[model samples]
Target: MFPTSRIPLMGGLSKMSSSLMANVVHTPSILNSRSTYILERARPLPRIYPRQRKRPYMNRSTYVYKVVQQPYDRLMRQQDLQVILVQYVEGLGKAGDIVTVNPNYAYNNLLLPKLAIYASPENLANASLYKKSAEEEAYSSKTSKTLMRLLPYHTIPVVLNQDNEWTIEPWHIKASARKVGIHVLNEASIQIPGPPIRGPDQSLHGKDFIAIFKVNNKETIKMRCKIFIWATKPAERNSIENQFWCFKGEPVHPEEKDDLDLLPIEQFNPDKIIIPSGDLENTIVCAS
Candidate 1:
């Protein structure tokens, strides 16, 4: 058939072809294995999220403050005063007398200047002693004794004006007594039988009314007084009783004259007397 040299050449070519086919198959398998190993070794990327910002919380019951304004002049004028005293001040009073004064004036003019001091217990006791001495001196005087004796004999005349009805108060008696050189210190010393004496009644007017005076609540002195109520014009003298002329020889009215002395004791009538209803038991009528 074929030639021996050509056969050997074909055999070498076939061997080369087979070797190349083997290399091509092995390369595809190696590439597939590498891709799988890389995929298994790698890790996934971490998740990313936006950050949230926080807000402050508000409360409902918070307190709010309001300021009030006042005027400067008004504040200055509202200064509170304090009470203090020391030695006698000309316009104020005697030593140990207590007084009220402005705080600023007291501190600056009195305390700091050494013009005065606070009224303490010791100073007040001294003042009481002085008051007692003055009272004792006044009681021992001649004027005081004369006033005491005169209370029994004196007849205080309370003249009623155009208004025939007059209210006789204890002070009215005191003021009337003062006009006649008598000084009544305590109003409680004078005693009236009824409520205040109110009258135009003929039984009370121009009649002897009794007033009791209790001196120091010990001695009881009886005073006989007359209340004269006459019209603006002169009236008949016979309209009044004989006792109206007891104090003076003549009547209060110029047209009238003293016609009689006090009535006789036997002729005294309890019905005609104007004594207080309460004093009916103690009252006694005596002719002078």
Candidate 2:
């Protein structure tokens, strides 16, 4: 007595129920346990870390220090430097920059600080001394140069007479001057010409001459003179012996005698002599 619609409801219901159970219960125990373990391990640990203690920076003072108060004395005692202590009204009191005494300490704490001003006694003393010395040296150098330029000539001439009475003639006086550095330039002696001669028959005849002196090949100054000797016999122009030599008598080599290159011979004439204003004390005569 089986029913006409009997298509095995039990089998179909059992398959449907099994499919529903498979779809509804999807949680995996192994996967869930692994995720739970990872989460537990990832949680922050409460570990103890020791705190590091930082060393405090030592504060330094800004002040200059030296072995002795007097910089010059201290410097003298030292082997190297020679210091001069000088006083200055300006910059009396200032602070010295803080400097490091040790390099092993942290550089931030050990290096010099920018809080210092110029306060070193040595530095101030050096500045003052240098200033004074510089001024004095400048003034002295200027004066020396001026004096050197002013004194162009140094020697004068004095004539010798028969009785040795010195008679300084204008020509001799003018020719006496010598340049300051080396020998006199363009030096010439004016010759004293012998007076006119009376002929054997007692006729009036004269020969007046001018002495010509030359430096190297160039002619220097000339001396005009007339001398009266036996019957007014004229003498050849040779009066340099009578003229005083400006230089002290020294035996000089012939080659060295002409080595002094001086001004030309034509410059000593009276026409070109122009005395500067208030410079008569330093008058220079020329060569002719």
Candidate 3:
């Protein structure tokens, strides 16, 4: 027969289990914030990726090169040099006067032009012959006043330098003036306002630019000098007129009377497109 105690214990367990299961409402566990956070922290984190930029599309065979050119520093970088002047340099000294300057300036502006000699023992010995130029006499002469009035009206022709470069230097300008019968005794006196002219600018074939004549570094005269390009073939390009038409008694080109683009208008081709004085709207409508 089954044991009476075992049977009672089994019946009690069944009653307790049935009661616990009957009409039971299941609910989620209430947790403290720290514990909840810990549970959330235990979960595997989602992966994050960095923002990527797409490279520009190009052909695999394509190549690009960045060209870097040296910066231009007026070429005034040489050490100070002592030079004996053989002619008058306005800011510096007169003939036979020894002065110190940038070696670049001394070479390019003075020594090369035969305006000054290097102060070697041989040169110093012959320095006695380097008499001061009669600059006062030259300037005070009767023709100087006329020259001042006429210089601005004259066209200054520039040429391709010995180096085959188009960059016009002060010495180049001085030589050009000498060739054209204009006497510019000193390169130091020729002052261009901006970065040196590098041309024959096709569009600006005949143009006037301002030049400052610093006389004795005391008086400054602003003159409008016309720039003319000199080339081997005259037939290739039109020659710029040697003089402007503004001065009274100067002949004006009747053909260029209507042109306002280039001054001294005489140098350029005449404006041939004459606009008929009829209504422009009607003309355009008719053409359309």
Candidate 4:
């Protein structure tokens, strides 16, 4: 015969014990050899990695280098420029003359204006022919000598008709000679003793001056001419005495003292005096 209370107590103890064993079986053991083997066999927990730094992005198309090439012939043409004149260019040469000039100058001033052509053999030949012809027709020494002889004896008169004060220039002397059947082509051929004649010191009126001419650029061939300024219309005066003031190496007159005082010291030469005759005495002469 089982006791009724002892039966219930035994049932409850069995239930509790079963629950405790289940819990013990589920828990991991630190000291157990089986647990240690399983842990060694399993893959290590996925390594926790610090976040990686992002790299900066760049577009390769944004950076680019380009090189430009110039043609070789274009550079060469600018350095070496040769041209020939089809027509006469003063200070350069006569027609058909070959010359070297800047490319821009040749194109704009010569080629564009049809004044010159490119240097060629045919143009050179023509230039040579022209030079030969010009030399043959050039003024001869005999003619130049004859002109030179006449220059010393003759006087060229320049008349300044303008009422206002005017300065005497080399051109004026040339023009005066031209009027008197003498042609002076080159300005350098005429030589003045002093600077260009200007007022109120050196006037263009009522004065007798001398100019030297270099005949045909020859050192030995020189001519001296008397240049007289006729402030008023020239009168009929054959002798130099009538045309100009005559001072025969005499003392300055009381009336002329005022004029002499007014004259520049450089112009007043005490030793020199204007003679009444055709011969110029004690005159200062300069030659170039």
Candidate 5:
């Protein structure tokens, strides 16, 4: 009775244990109810974040070039060449028939020194008679002035290969088209604008006029040409197709006609034609 005021600590511990047991028994239903409420209110993840899909990469397109070939069956007509020489002739005799001048005549005489042959006496007599009957006109005088102007030789004709890789030098003038492998139509001297002494030092070379032909079973060919010539003048770059003739022998002036035929250097096509650039000193190509 005298110590009754102090309640035992054992009683408090027992009470706390009882309360915890009650909470454990009732807590299951409470937790189930909370879970139901959460299920109703919860939201799903964003659509973008669900699954990552890779985008396909794109590629650039390419283009191709096409080359067209012509039909081999296409035919070209060829005609025989008839040489017409118009020169200051003393007369036409058996001995005066077309004579070829020696190439050395130019050096010997100034321009051309070579002499193929001299006019015979009989030819001289005929020439004298013809001269007497016809009106005395100067040899330099233009005969058939209108027709002479129309002559093909007055303008040179040149054909260019595909790709325009090859071009004639002395590129100032343009060439007219003439029958292949034939006499120059108009045979007039090219007119130089300035004095004779002040002409261009660099004319197209005889060797630059390249000719291609087929040979024998050995697949041989010939080219009568020299190496390519570069332009000394800047303006000449566009003038590559100028008409110029290359002969085997010395070139004849419009006033002189002493050649029966012109010799040409010929070569096989594709196999023999070549163009090299930039100090090509050691490249010596021989063609037959």
Candidate 6:
């Protein structure tokens, strides 16, 4: 009953849809003909999650540095600098002495300051005749390297005035050190790394405090110093026996255990003195 032209139009529509259905039925076979990787972007992606965070810089257990060591000769050629002192460079070397130093230090501090010169044949020849300057002459005698060797073993005693509100000062220590033949000429070089000892605190008495001393400009030396409050009263004064300036651990105050005596109050005895801790004696030994 339809017109011939309209019939062909309907048939064409049905034929096209049937072709689409056929292709759908064969979809797996068609896809198999093409590469599987094409559908998957490239290949199967790795098993990493969508977003991963990194550990904090400070919290990281591993560092990303590698050490590469070179030959000693190579390092000496590059990093080390040979110099001759035109003037004395304290802590480095004296004039006329050929010395090796850091390249940067040789350039900036020595060469730039005119304190030193490069080691040349002509300069090396003349270096031996150079005498130490006046300042160097004076200083060398005062602060000797011997002091560094001696100071570590001995505890320098600094006596402070009792009943005075004075805090420990460097000058008070310098005076005490000089008497013991330790040449601490400059008070500026001394530093107390401990808390201030103000007034006459009995708890602080006979306690060894650490003091740091700067040697030259480059080296540091540490010494132990015991601060003792000068006893103004006779009974409270340091006993003439058993302990000289300080007791073994703590001082037994006369009020606490004078005659009640749990601690020994042994009398001073200077023998031919084969004892382990013999009494300190003034002996006349004639060394012929």
Which numbered prediction scores highest in lDDT against the true structure? 6
* Ten contiguous residues with the weakest lDDT in model 5: 279-288
The true-versus-predicted C-alpha distance at residue 121 of model 6, in Å, is 11
10 residues in a row with least lDDT, candidate 3 = 30-39
Prediction-by-prediction clash tally: 0, 9, 0, 0, 19, 0
lDDT of 5 by residue, 1-288 (tens): 223224332212444444444433333233312221111213333345336675433223212223232222122112222111223333321211343343343234322322222344554445433332123433322233322333322222232332234433322222322223223233232232211211122343322232222211112122222223445444443232211222232232322222213322232344433442322221221110
Report lDDT per candidate. Answer: 0.48, 0.29, 0.50, 0.48, 0.29, 0.54
lDDT of 4 by residue, 46-81 (tens): 344478355434345334433232223343223656
lDDT of 4 at 48: 41
The alpha-carbon deviation from the true structure for residue 232 of candidate 3, after best TM-score superposition, in angstroms, is 2.1
In model 6, residue pairs whose N, Cα or C atoms come closer than 3 Å (at least 3 residues apart or on different chains), thus clashing, are none
lDDT of 1 by residue, 1-288 (tens): 223333222222344454444433333233312221111213333333456254334333222223332223443243544434444444544444566677787778777866566556665555443332434332333233454554555556555543456777777778766655566789998885545566655455565555567665555665655565645555421144433323433322222222212221123344565443332112212222
Best by TM-score: 6
Q: Please provide, for model 2 over 146-226, each residue's C-alpha lDDT reduced to its tens digit, 9 standing for 90 to 100.
A: 333333223222222232223334354334333212243433433323332222221111122233333333334332222
User: Would you list the rank order by TM-score, best first?
Assistant: 6, 3, 1, 4, 2, 5
The TM-scores, one per candidate, come to: 0.31, 0.18, 0.32, 0.30, 0.17, 0.39
Residue 73 alpha-carbon offset, candidate 1, angstroms: 74
- Model 3, 224-277: lDDT tens digits are 444544455545544323132222221122332233223332232244332323
